[model samples]
Target chain A: METVLRDAAAASRGAPLRALTVRVGPLSGVVVDSLRFAFESLAPGGPAEGARLVVEETKPAFRCPDCGTLYETPVGDYHCPACDSVRGELVAGNEMELLSIEV
Target chain B: MCESCGCGETNPHLHEHGHGHDHAHGHDHGHDHGHGHVIPVRSSALALNQRLADQNRGWFRAKGWTVYNLLSSPGSGKTALLERTLAAVPGSAALVGDLQTERDADRLRASGAPAVQITTGETCHLDAHMVAHALDKLPADGIRRLFIENVGNLVCPASFDLGEKVRVVLLSVTEGEDKPLKYPVIFREADLVLVTKTDLAAAVGFDRDAALANIRQVAPRAAILDVSAKTGAGLDAWYRWIEAPAS
Candidate 1:
């Protein structure tokens, strides 16, 4: 993570880099709150440190077999709202994407 | 760490296979190993893929192409359906995903439909990132319909979103009608359901009503179509529904 930040800084050619925002999907296996905490802890006193960190938590998508409603599933618990099934389709959730590093 | 079992900590085998005790015949351990170190992987490996999927979704929307993801079990006629569809609708492109063979792409290409094969290296499902890579490699230029035929696995593919507008889960009539109820998640997530191999319906004793009921039970709002790629029976309805403006 630190190495990627340094590369981003170098690529910017010393221009001030702003917040590093990322999208964390539930199925992506990455915890959003924890990642944000780690970022704040790791980004201090570094070349790309001190910049604001933003982590966007993406809800895991679920589709109810009974209703076919495509909606987000809650973390840790795999339950379908429309059908009340413990199991359903996890359409999208697992994702940790570096959207962009704004300079 | 035990070379035979990969048990770094407790010897679970010792309790079962210890000494003269018939149940413990094979058990032998030198010391009481401590608990295994649990590493919390707080990072999502799919983040990069999801971002690319979002970008792909945006690209598809911008280009006004209706992206359809076709998923089914192997030999369920997903490629054959696409091949038939290409014959019906000219100028449509497809990105086919498979574990090994490029035979599907070759068949589609023979039908005058430009198709690309994405062979996943032992991966069960095709993720959004893979789809993005395949799209770049395939070059969907001047294409109206974009079909992403996912790897032939009903289980894993239901978990990943490949930035498609519609998820079409096909079930061949030859396959049991109870499949939808058994694999409810895939059926539930599908926006449309295509019941293939209708020509063999009677020969295989495939109950059409029971299958439709099972589908409705799993996905109440999904549009169900029974199509025979062999006879082209009900193919026009399938085509019109897919090409319809409302969809």
Candidate 2:
């Protein structure tokens, strides 16, 4: 979470850290509540203290390499419905990122 | 102070933006100075770590070393596979990650490879920073291949990139065939899925076809190989894959 603080400060040109917007994907292995808890606990008396945090959750997006069909990976079914191509690239989601900071 | 929300006197921003109704014409300075605007970053939370990982990748590539990041659950036979690979290949080095034990590192060393143990303590995954620090501890200069045995985990480690040329996820036959289905994120990004401990498949009633189908579904692009450290089954093919320039 300090990474968010430090990066927000950097992005804001050394301005006092302010509210942050983060994107946490479902498959990012991060729990939003846990991240919020961490921020609340770790931000006191720091640059990000009292900073408003907005988390944007994203769904996983997969693109089939064979036919370029893009779809969400359905539960237990990974093969592309159109081409039967199992070689689908995960193009989105799986993201834990800092989207913006209000400084 | 030509005008614009008394901020024109102190705020450098408003002076440059006199484009009418820009909160102009002398207003109160009682409001928060740093309010109103949001800057978009749109960067990975691991951006710094990623930059470091990229450096490690380029460094390893420049040194002509093909690095592999090994991921799996605990008891997935990662150390066992590496022990065999290092013993057979001769010029391989390893960086082992565990919560606390140096046992994996010691075992690899005994197998005639320079190995460094990174005890991550509480960290579930090994990061590029740790890998960079461990690189100095091992004599990997002349080694052709470097294996990073990631801390035995299926989920957390998947998000951290270790700057490896190939990512190999091991699934021991003893570990249920539904592992890939259960942990699709890790398997989805794997380059090679080594189905280990094949010698015990029959005894364990491991469903080979189901496992293969699941692996293909999750990691169709990954080269799948069956290997057993105890019985040396399919090891020759494993070694060839490692040695193959096409990999």
Candidate 3:
């Protein structure tokens, strides 16, 4: 929970960290459940001890470069439904970001 | 769940037997609880690594070096290819990554090029920070070409940026033709796709056409090269691609 301690500068050093929320994108290659498991197993004896870990999944979003069509993959459908664009820029779903911490 | 902390507790972040506190950041003014607070971080987990990677990219560019990040499965002949490349090309250096041991680095150094080994312990992929640290250990200067042989994995290395001028993904002929389709993340990031072990293609019943088609399907933009490091068959073309600057 080094990230939690670093970001929890507002709280006292020994303040009991209550929770942690993180944003996980689809293309980030991180499993949400596994992340929670790791956090739970590692949080003890630290500032974030007994902290509840919350992981929010981001929908895989893609922006068509040619037709400017925005698409989301909730069902593993990556191709643009609006336009058949081969080169779609990833607008989201490629990040593993820490959102906030409560202490 | 409470909106502040996503904790089911009615008064989330509120301390039991609360006391008036002089905490840092002063962001606890609005909430019912005065002592507890939720700080918004809003930063990537890999922020430090990404920043270091950008710095490495800048430094390599300043030195006019063409660095290639080589990725493949274990036993895909990445070291063999590098051994040949270091022997074939002049002013080239390498950084080989492995879970343990410095054998790959020793083999590369024996190829008559300066090579450094980065033992990652238990890490599956080589992050930018590790490369920056290992770059310090490498002593050779005026390195025209720098090859960073990433840990032999198809999955994890795709997400880490190593500040390479280009990424070369190797798919050995012994590995099935559908590997590109299976590991699309790494295949899609390829600037060059090298089909290694061509000398054993026939003996291994490797379908060259199907493999080329699969590579084209996943990485249409990457320049495909069929190279047999054992026979030195396609080494000339790979060397040419190295010498020719990015277009």
Best by lDDT: 2
DockQ (0 to 1) for model 2: 0.45
Candidate 2 lDDT by residue in tens digits, B103-132: 999999999889999998888999876787
Colliding pairs, model 2: B4-B24, B4-B25
Query: After superposing candidate 3, which stretches have Cα over 4 Å from the reference?
Result: A1-14, A73-85, B1-38, B245-247
Instruction: Report the Cα lDDT for residue B161, model 3.
Output: 89
Where does model 1 sit among the CAPRI classes? incorrect
Error of 3 at B32 (Å): 8.9
lDDT of 3 at A37: 72
TM-score of chain A of 1: 0.62
Ranking the candidates on lDDT from highest down gives 2, 3, 1
Tens digits of per-residue lDDT for model 1, B1-247: 0234353233233212111111211344332344311111223334344455677898899887888999888889898899989877866889999889888899988878789898887878888766765676665477888889999987778767788888899999988998887776677667789999999999999988888888887765578888999999989988987886233
Provide the overall lDDT of each model, using Cα atoms, as 2-decimal numbers: 0.70, 0.81, 0.78
Clashing pairs in 3: none
**TM-scores of chain B alone in all candidate structures, in the order given:** 0.80, 0.84, 0.84
> Could you tell me which 10 consecutive residues in candidate 2 chain B have the lowest summed lDDT?
B16-25
TM-score of candidate 2's A chain against the true A chain: 0.86
